[model samples]
Target: MAGPMISHSPAAPPRPGPGRRVVLGRRVVLGAALGWGAAGLAGCGAGREPVQRLRLATGPEGGPYNAFGRALAAATQGHAPAVVPLATAASVDNLHRLDDGSVELALAMADTAEDAVRGRNSFGRPLPVAALARIYVNYTHLLAPADGPVRTVADLAGRRVAVGADGSGVQVVARRLLETASLTGGAGRVAEVPLALGESVAALCAGRVDALFWSGGVPTPAVAELARELPLRVLALDGPAGVLRARYGPVYTAAEFPAGVYGLREPVGTVGVGNYLLARTDVPADAVCAVLRTVFDAWRDLLREVTAGARLEPRFAVSTGAVPLHPGATAYYRSVYG
Candidate 1:
């Protein structure tokens, strides 16, 4: 069952465009890998005239959010009215944008969305957010200069680092990783520079920053290409995990970066977290249902971005712990399971 090739950002890789062997998450793709039986969205909206337009918030040009968002927009062309993929800071920024009514639906890391919903950490206060789906796992990438003084997280201390822009999932994860490594700046030695996802790589390459922490799918095009141009190394997060999980919820999972990814000399041990599709709690149930129905109905279309998971089952869709599932999504899941 092949289909049209989706044109994603120019910054990402050129091969295996969407429906290849690219794998993501604890299980895999929510579309075919999960073997979801699509019954169409006809039951989602019922008699409604259909939504007119929708705004989707994704990460910068070279990240997963942007790639998935475009594929999503294409899938929603007729079903969701109109979906517009807008590039933002990713996760934290996307939630804030959704909170402020700038975008109707946004993609975010589960941990960041939990913080926004509970008004903790980088999130200023409690926000009204609901989860539509738990998509894939974003492995934390702690990239450093190959020729620099960094081998482990300890070396990040006293270095100029790019920890994503304000209101971004990268900021949330970077701060937590630093805390996990017990490297929250000794005497304010670590200079944290916040930059947009589109800017982080360039800054590190130009000698503007020592390293940049990123959370995304494997072989993230920008970082993969950057490794070829610059001597880069990934730092392993082999530190205490229980404390961070207890403090930040169960979003973080133990994961490994394969040895060959980004041309690393050896496999880097890191953490993995779930990325989610989030929406406002105020959105109509049927409208939300319609959107998700289209997602699953057209799940195959998202194959390029939401790589097929290996062992995950569609029944695990509602497993997101903190963020409550959107009624529409729940309804669709109910229909799928029941």
Candidate 2:
């Protein structure tokens, strides 16, 4: 009478064997797969939209533009969308990509971007694009060895100089500056050797070349390393200061590299242009907003990551001459400041 009514029949079919347990596990796995498939279909129809992918074209490896591109990729990884960075030839090439729909984003020198959008200077046709931000300034430095006699731009006459590789922004500006200084004549020669930055430094140190022109961000690693090991002098281009400013529309500014800033004995005054991020006009507004948000939000983190990042600021983003702001980026700027 005690447990007659509560007795389980035959111990409820005996606990399942290992084989039965295996079957049960298989059923669970199958059921989970089906449920996930259904949820995914539902998500496609009514849930969050799929993440968008963007391709950012940057400069040559080991350059400021490339470094910034990498930082941008890291910053936007966990964001709503995904961004991909493509290492390419510097500013001019990047502009071409933006125009042809080859890339959604690009890192370009402000001067180059200006030229592209207005069909002036390097760009032969008007390119439809907009600026996302001004990330840094590319200071044009004239690198000469300590014992070399090329003290100033004037002294470069009758001397060999490496004006960077062909199609490089360095070469374009170097030629312009040389022309302005009257340094390009039968007596003076420019060797168009397409060498990497490291190789150019070595060539200069070895006396194979008298001078090299480099347009890049402050604290450039190649220049810094060369300055440390060898006695180097960055010639102050003072002869055509007024001419460059007048011709280039004031986007060109006279900036000083203070003594010890790059192991220099005295401050060196040089001309420079700001660097900015460019995007094709066709990029979605939402994507542009996401990119701008990521960049400005992680500005501090980026500064710590790259030397050039320290110059990226909201105010600088709007300080451009020819490059117009993208509507999305302008919206973000107004939201943050106003």
Best by TM-score: 1
> Model 2, residue 71: what's the lDDT?
82
| Cα-based lDDT for every prediction | 0.71, 0.68
> What does candidate 1 score on TM?
0.81
Clashes of each: 9, 0
Question: Each model's TM-score?
Answer: 0.81, 0.80
| Cα lDDT tens digits for candidate 1, 112-143 | 88888889877779999888787666777888
Best by lDDT: 1
- Show where candidate 2 strays beyond 4 Å: 1-51, 305-309
